[model samples]
Target chain A: MSNVSATLPRKARVPIFVVLVLVGISIAYPILYLAFTAFRTRADYLGNPFGLPSELTLQNFISVWNNYGIGRALLNTVIVVAVGLTVQLLVAGLAGFALARYPVPGARYISGALVSVMLIPSQVLIIPIYLLLSRIGLVGSLPGLILVYVATGLPFATFFLIVTYRSLDTSVLEAARVDGAGFWRTFLSVASPMAIPGLATLLVLQFIAMWNELLFAYILLPNDQLRLITPALAQIGGRFTNDQPFVAVGLILTALPPLLLLSFAAKYVMSGLGASFGR
Target chain B: MTSPVLAAPVASASAGATGARPPGRARWRTSERLVGIAAVAPAVVLVLGFMVYPVCYAIWISFNKTNGLSFDYVGLDNYTKLLADPLLHKVFLTNLIFLISVPLVILAALVCSVLLYERIRGWRFFRVLFFVPNVLSTAVIGLMFKSLFSYRGPINAVLAQFGIPPVDFFAGAGSAIFVIIIALVWSGFGYQTIILLSGLSAINPEIFEAATVDGAGWWKRLWYITLPNIRGVLALVSILNVLYTFTALFGFIFVMTAGGPGYDTTTLDYLIYTLAFSSTRLGEGAALAVMVFLLIGGLTALQLRVFRVSEEN
Candidate 1:
């Protein structure tokens, strides 16, 4: 590996470096544009859509928050994502723990079922999920949306956690059991602590996924008053095509939580990806 | 340390075997089983309720004419109608066209990952920057691209600077699909790069060194050593990209072109959405949904088979 780069002559190095830089710019430029445009006044954007803003202002953000009901949407998103993430983690954690540590009857079948469902894209289930939710009168409710998120999220979350828990050092768990710790005690005191990195990775991943989820949230909560951040942004983007700055603000707000999470837990997220696919 | 650690299970086993302890052990074993059942029950219940049941219901409703409130037995009618639907044909063709983005993504990811693996200057920053798109919501990326490629947007502005007329990118099917493909590749290649990077990292560095000693140049080494070593990961990434193109492009299409100047860019997922919700053709939508489910399932099975074959080899 060391000599691989050294063997490249100086001339080849420059072009490779330049190509890397160009690719980096292509990735960064549009995001930077969104950020710059979000802070620009409508008039400034209109005058010079591609140029640096003459003056940055909070007016676009404020306008979107107040006029587009993005504030409410943000709150809705927070409630749904927070509650859904907690439930999904708890349920998946328990199930993953059981499958990993205990001789649960039909464990193999249970795992097979989970893995199979993980392959079924949620889009394919949207029709029936919608009908099922409506049948239970959860058609336009946050709790209903939360239920869908947790359910759809469970298969992969449980599968991931199962892999995580299974890879844990068994000696520690054995020691815990030797100390007279029962199942829940061993799980909570020993297994759970050991699996913090996995849980954290799962938390960050599921949070981002649930936060960015649109279809079920949009379809299930068709009422504008209860729109989540993503669907709200889509609505704003679709409606105000010419109001670029306003739409940009909405887009930024919608993306901010996950981006913030990514910045903080990027290592965990990347490791989680590696772990998921490494098997 | 090993003695005590090893003794715990043996101690419990011997105690259970003792004359006075059989009933107690049996009780403990039963309770443990119950606890295990209790622990796994929530996930099982949720999966049964939402996933398993919804799929069965989707299959059932695919054979009926229903609009959420009503169902009339129209056995094979929904399926036949969808099978004959020209719009569905166009949608599938559009999806096939979008599949073109998967190879583009794989190629881009391959080059980027290989370049980054060389530890180029600022590789770390580029890695994070490339991954920024993966973190952002696809809707946001879609809208950003939509704005950038709009008639008066930045892309057109850049063209004007080059003495070319502004292009209305979304005015036609070809350009609209082009814009979506660009967005998909831009946002997609990064995640694949990360995956490919991990795959590349798993390769034995000694092989590269040995290849270098044999006078294998960079391209030759990559084509021979790097490419063959990461073939499994490449296949995984391809399938993932295909899946993303099939299911996850809804957000992009929803925001960017809204399925087009006509049915020109309507992907299968987006078609299901329009049919079930917008057009209130739930029966037909469910039919298409079933078809999509089977398509994905078949793809996944094929991936597993590929892995199994690769493992055997």
Candidate 2:
């Protein structure tokens, strides 16, 4: 695959490579700029915004963590994502498995309903979800936000896993059933084990999603202390216009988890993208 | 019904003794049904309780006037007010302007994907690098752009070297929308490229070889062969980008411009937030939400029709 440029003459390849490299730099430069700005003092950044930092400093990171309440936000986000991902996976996984394999009553309708739910623009749901959460006394709480994430996330997650489960070797599931393994037993001991790759893909996709979700997290968790990392970054960025480096630190912190996940689980993340669009 | 593995086991079980109904088969069927219901119950319940219920409530709220807590049935009053509201019209226009980014993103993605399809050196690295922005939170991307395009930001610094004075990228509605569109394209094209690359990979290499033998140059091959082959994927990508532009732009607008320069860059999604939460006009916001929802549905359906017609060719 590496040398598949047969149609391109040797001379043309250089310009193509050059254009790609320039595009690559253009895509990467903003992020790289953020990192460089984050490490510099405010004065250094203001004086030389485009150049490398004259002197490295941890002041921005420390101040953002301490004074900007990013520490609390980080902890809050972890709790939401951790609790949210687990419940989302459990609900989506079981439903996906059952719908795919079992002769569930109304399975087609249910599947169709889930797909339609994905079509509903979430903006329409926000006002009412906020109202409902408040009515249920979960509004402005992490648990309420978690519920929103799971609810909004279920349609796609369940759909993705259904595709995953359907592609699993049915003979393995049949063997488990023949051994008298019930649904739960087979799910835990046989089917899910074989579905680890699919589950991992869903997990990575959902992890990044929940980690980066802004609107619901911002709307549901109005308390400053309860702000998720993304919303916290937004608030800090909005509040401190003069302190670019400090805000850059917040952006870096907000982006770090997903970027790390991308680095380590790029395959799973990229694979999940196709599943998302049902391609 | 289509599962041979499932049917095979059941057939063997029934054939073991008399052709009469298997005694435990009925019990097992009931158990299986029970298990299926149980497995799917949590998802069904949550979706119903949260998604379905809120949408219904939003429909109700859209017809009546309410803040957030209480509602008095005003019966189309909210919808009437929004219909007459100039801000809604302006915001709708803003959204339409944002739609321009979709084609821009697709064009960039097409070029990159075509180049990458050749399997040039470092294609893999470039693929991943391009997708990095897609993984980052919108808030991060928005803020990164905010800083990058700020009057005193690096963009201005670089411009100063060219003797072009600093430009306040966010001061006016025109400049602000331009900045937002640029940010949208910058962040969006990478993912679309990845999708297009996958679509490209699905095309037979033999087709390209045959085209090469037929004296088709690279651009000619791309124009005649590559473009037609990926039309379906391009359609899919276009629809996704359209939906994204309409629905998923709140965070970007929120952090980047906050719909700034006096409602110039306020997208429909962002306006919904401001109306419902900031201004406490929940009824009108809900009405706007419904309108946006319908608009998106209609636009998506229209695009599907257009693309389907083209695809048939």
Candidate 3:
């Protein structure tokens, strides 16, 4: 170990290692505190914020689930994420592929317009969306929330996909055309397979964005049945103001799905997010 | 999207190269156009319905007074009232407070990315640890950090161990801004670091190896080789980071401090939310929203122009 460390400069190594250790602690501290507080009794937490539990208990998770209906909320969240991502990928993919491959008139205008739409803050658009959704009786529906999610997620998705598509080798696309493949054939067989990493990356991003979306979900879904996890968790916390453990559980429940999704697909997400920045 | 240059060649290639055109080629063209339009129509219509038309409506709202669902065309009244609103000015400063985190967080992410790029052991584990906060919901993060930063909370507890006074963390404009910045930087830097790490990775190794061979140390190599190569990524990340951090509602601000001890951390996004929901001044809120939209749009456009120049190189 000493011999291995000798290749690196000692002066540089010590500070770098120390900085890394500090960072690692800082990042881990909150997560550990979260777990610790959730398990501890209220008195225990008050006494020692960082101490181990005297007696480990499942009461917090249990009470949180039964009282807050996290199970139903979880189901609702899965639907939103699944449906939202599917619609987003479909719309974003078609738009991206068309913008990349076709020579439709006003194509540049459309592409530029879509990219510009990305800059419009959701706060500016949320009221109008709510009004429109109300008019169409979509304000309280799962499908309605999914529709809004797709729209909001579209701009970045299309932009990222378009960039990735353009970077793909054109000769491969040319070969598909020469073999008498149509647009759909070329997209599926030639373009998409090669763009898997990029698409996977987009999928992960869109999922996280849609999953964590609060404003629209809060405004649109009034009924508990339709409420997605984010706003649902907020609602849960509001109901049990005194239940610190319940609030803790709500936080964990809200956080766990995305944490699982990201940890499972960390590499792809990192690549996808980094790709648009040309990483 | 394919550039116009690429598009023209592709269209002609389809039409001219297949011996004489097939009989149904015209039909194919029409079908292709229809398919293309159909593909892009939903997205365009959604944006038009949600953003474009509504933004125009909001501008008109700024000129009128609306009570809930009722509209009364009192031209310039709402705008004038908004101008006189002291809270609006506070909201503006609050947004500025959020913006203060952008440079600080970006610097942290840059340093973290550089460290990880050194090919350190357990780099993946560190990356995940840093990124865990980002994956969590902003509200939940807000809740947890509120506890952590509370008066008798762990942070203050730690401070007490050092014999420092328990500062009123969320008590004032400056300290409230400071806490929010720390939270924003903690939760935010992971994504930026990930972007920077990839950017660092994308830098060609040969450039650095060349620098090393020329007796350039790590700092010299980073300055001359790594930094220049990742200029495009750096520009892109910074633009996105600034936009995102600027628009963030200061969720922790909302849950923890409620934009107070006074209106210290009430950012534009939160102000709009509070105005609409709490104050029920929908017209003024719409105006504020429009102003924020325009400001972000202009800045983003400028950023794109700057980044595009680097990308071209």
Q: How high is the lDDT of residue B229 in model 3?
A: 80
Ranking by TM-score: 2, 1, 3
Candidate 3 chain B — worst ten consecutive residues by lDDT sum?
B16-25
Error of 3 at B237 (Å): 4.5
Write candidate 3's Cα lDDT for B77-109 as tens digits. 776787798988877766765787888888898
Please list the Cα RMSD from the true structure of every candidate, rounded to 1 decimal place: 6.2, 5.3, 5.4
- Clashing pairs for model 3 are none
Docking quality band of candidate 2, CAPRI definitions: medium
Superposed by TM-score, candidate 1 places the C-alpha of residue B64 at a distance from the truth, in angstroms, of 0.5
Rank by DockQ, highest first: 2, 1, 3
Question: Could you tell me which residue pairs clash in candidate 1?
Answer: none
> In model 3, what is the error at residue A118, expressed in angstroms?
0.7
Per prediction, the TM-score for chain B is: 0.88, 0.89, 0.82
Candidate 1 docking quality: incorrect, acceptable, medium or high: medium
Better of 1 and 3 by lDDT: 1
lDDT of 1 by residue, A1-279 (tens): 453567677788888898899999998788879889999988888777877889999988877888988889989998998899999999999999987777565565667678778878777789999988888899999999999999988989999988888889988877777688999898888899989999999898888888888888889999999999999999898999999988889888888877888788878888787755522
Which is the better candidate, 1 or 2, if ranked by lDDT?
2
| TM-score for all models, in order of appearance | 0.92, 0.94, 0.85
lDDT of 2 at B95: 92
The chain A TM-scores for the candidates, taken one by one, are 0.95, 0.96, 0.90
Among these predictions, the greatest TM-score belongs to 2
